[model samples]
Target chain A: MEILLAIVIGAAFGAVLDRIGASNPTVIGKMLNLTSLKLMKTILLAIGTGSILMFGGQMLGLVDVGHMSVKTAYVGVFIGGLLLGAGWAVAGFCPGTGLVAAASGRKDALFFIAGGLLGAAAYMASFPWVESTGALQGVLGGKVTIGAVPGSGYDGLFSALPGDIAGLVMGAAFVVIAFALPERLNPRGERLARAH
Target chain B: MTLSWKSGGVLLGVVFFLAVLLVKPIGVSTQFVIFDGILWNAVDSAVVTQTAEGVTSSNAYLAKSDGKYAKAVANPLNYSFVFVIAMMLGAAVSVWARGGLDRAERTMPALWRANFGDGAGKRYLAAFIGGFVVLYGARLAGGCTSGHMMSGMMQTSISGYIFALGAFAAAIPTAMMLYKEG
Candidate 1:
């Protein structure tokens, strides 16, 4: 039953990814290069709105804080993020969007997926050696939130600003930026138009 | 109406909210780890058992009761795996509906071609290397862009914000250096 629901949700999510031109490497590259803000605007709006719904629901006691899965802060995560960013810029696809791109029949995406799976497998295989290196150590295990809520198993980043208020402010800021950002067509698009 | 970036973003946000409301946070990186577990389980159940018990180098974190890896190993048809497969199905369906099937090809885009040249072998090699590095980093960090950045930021986790900052800090510079203006 849960799996079925997941499928439906995943399908909708995939469709949204595709519709936003996330399946196109050209679009992704342009966004990364700051040549266009279309994808960035969409991403900001999505994150902002999601933040409001989640934190807002928690504040109202309508959502169970226990249901949320929060990750720990660690030095490894920060460093890994740098590597992931580099990979994303070079490959033009993240893990999730790569799957969607492959599904959309992009052969390059299939290669990317293959590479990702192999990479994951390699990581697993080398787990023993890697774990011993202490690279994955130094974790701050407790949950950290921007504001406080009763029975929430997390710490607030700021004592003065409540989590809900902070979330609301950030969410609203993103929405405003999304609205203000103007989309520019990439040079590739202009070149294609000229050819046509 | 056809989906635009703005509307699509709104819809994605709503779907993400619904996902959190109905189940848990949405992420795709851990699904790969689960796949790794399944593969190990197939080759040698003992290795998986050892790994789960922290007897091996493989991380025991995912084998926790609430972990996605645990769910996947318990049942190959788990929620994360199904979600990923459905993502592909949804994309295929959308492409078919839009008559884009015929347009699908194994080729690099103009931007990539302009920068990296039009060699299929070289493109695939780059793709493969990039994919490997990204997944490796995601596993090491215990999350990917979706898991750490999107889902994390929504929940107001400081790590999420930091990860996003780090990602953009590296990604923007890398893109600027690699990007060739056409």
Candidate 2:
């Protein structure tokens, strides 16, 4: 049941992403170019809709806030984000979406999967060394997510902003960024160029 | 709109109902551990260890990414991986039914054929880096882009929003440098 639900959701998610031209690297590139905000617009829409639902659900006592979230402020995340950006620019697919494209029969997607698996293996094999190295470990020495949130000066042992409020803040921020900001360049032909 | 959210929702509902009613929930990462675990076991049994203190660990850090759509598989009954394998196959069927599949050479640029991509060995390097980075971010942040950013956002996760902001912050710069208007 869980698996079925997951596939259905995943498929819909993939379809939506596909329809919006997310599968196309050019669309992403254009969004980056300061030329178009279509991608940003779509993302803002998704986040906006999602947060609204969450907030409503929380207030109505329909959703479990604790189970609905993950740990926060992971230092490794920052470094990982830096690395992910470099790869997205070069390879054009993240792990989940790469599979989506491959299923869509894009040959490059297959290559992406193979590389991903091998890469995963390689990282595991080298974890001990990676931990010792200055590149990643240096940035996050003994700082685990949720464990070390740099003393907010609040004395409670376990505390975080309520999930709903956080969601509202994030949702509002995206909406502001999407509409307030002008096209970095010109919005011309970005839809056609990137999404193919 | 060409497609109604209701239709999509119904399809998902049906899939979920059926999955829960008969099959296990859809998952994908488990299929990987079969290959990954075996490789780890082959490399050094020492890496796959069970602590007397009851702290279980694998050399393969996939243990970190045991998310809703992904499960932790230590051995046989790696049913989760099996489920992901099924999901991917299901995805293929869905795509094939739509008559939308193509070869990479037919679409992607041969940028590496020149000396530009020589720095990274074509698809090999690109894929390797992509997999490594996405998962690393996923694990570090306690979720993949899907679980952390996409799913998190969908469920109204503040962490997801943070991840998204972080993603754009990084993506905006890199997307500019590597891809020139083409």
Candidate 3:
């Protein structure tokens, strides 16, 4: 039953990713380069809306706090994120988008998948060394949330503040920014001329 | 016919929210690791061993979490892995429903052509390299954009916020360096 639900849910998520132009590397490039903000805006709005809904539902008892999965805070997480961003800018696809694009029949996506497999293999091979570096060690109380939420076992950095409220506030900010952002930060024509 | 960005964004949000509410958060990168483990296990039976204790991998990374990853590698049909496969199918379905790839999808993007040439080989190489870097970094970071940033922020995880900041900090400058022509 759960596996069936996973299929249904995963398909919906993929379809949405495609419809949002995330399956297109060009669109991703535009978002990162500020050539076009359509994809970026869409991504932000989605994140913001999801955050609001999840946090709000938790507040209303429609979502389970225990179900919320929080990743550990570690130095390597931040550093790895930096590296991932650089790759995202270069390739115009993250792991999810890459898979979606491949399924969408973008030939390059296949290559991306191959690359990802090799990369994962490399990581698996070097896991011991990476672990020895202590980058995996937890930081900021390991799995702490920004604000405390009742019933969640994890501690909050701000114990007095409610996590749901904090999430809602942050989500709202993303929505506002998504709406306020211009279609393109710098005109493509202007950048082209400057390049020459 | 594609949905407008506004509608797409809202719908995407709803999908993610429903997943979190009904099941679990949406994540994809960890499956890549599991896939690698599966391939390695097939090549060398020793990579993953099924003992009375349960599935265990020679690889420490997979053996961690009490061999949760090793178990997934052995089983291979669990929710998370199946979800990723379904995602690919869903994307193919979307394309089929849309009457197949439009001109933009069929060809290199205009922005890409403006900066990089129309060489398919170059694009493929770059894509592969990029994929390699992103996946490697994701594993190092413990998650990808989906798991760490999107889902994490939704759950208000502090690590998520930090990851986002770190990602954009590196991404913005890198984009500027690579794509001066827009």
Model 1 Cα shift for residue A158 (angstroms): 2.0
Deviation from native of the Cα of residue A153 in model 3, angstroms = 1.4
Q: Model 3: how far is A63 from its true place, Å?
A: 1.3
- Candidate 2, DockQ to 2 decimals? 0.27
Listed per model, the TM-scores of chain A against the true chain A are 0.85, 0.74, 0.93
Model 3's alpha-carbon lDDT is: 0.85
Report the lDDT tens digits of candidate 3 across residue range A1-196.
Answer: 9899889999999888888888787777767777678877887888899989988888899888887888899998999899889888888889999999888887777888899998888888888999999999999988988887678887888888887898899889878888998878858735654676
DockQ values for all predictions? 0.64, 0.27, 0.73
Clashing pairs in 3: none
> For model 1, how does the per-residue alpha-carbon lDDT over B1-182 read when each residue is reduced to its tens digit?
23676887788788788788888888898787777777766776654444454333234555444444655665778777898889889977887788774342447766788777778888888788888988887877778878888888877777787678878888888987888564
Q: Rank the candidates by DockQ, best first.
A: 3, 1, 2
Q: Could you tell me how far off, in angstroms, the CA of residue A35 lies in candidate 3 after the best superposition?
A: 1.9
* Maximum-lDDT candidate: 3
Best by DockQ: 3
Decreasing TM-score order of the candidates: 3, 1, 2
Candidate 1 Cα errors over 4 Å, as ranges: A128-142, A184-196, B50-71, B101-105
Could you estimate the TM-score for every candidate? 0.89, 0.68, 0.95
Docking class of 2: acceptable
TM-score of chain A of 1: 0.85
Candidate 1 C-alpha lDDT tens digits along A81-124: 88889988999888998888888877788788888888787776
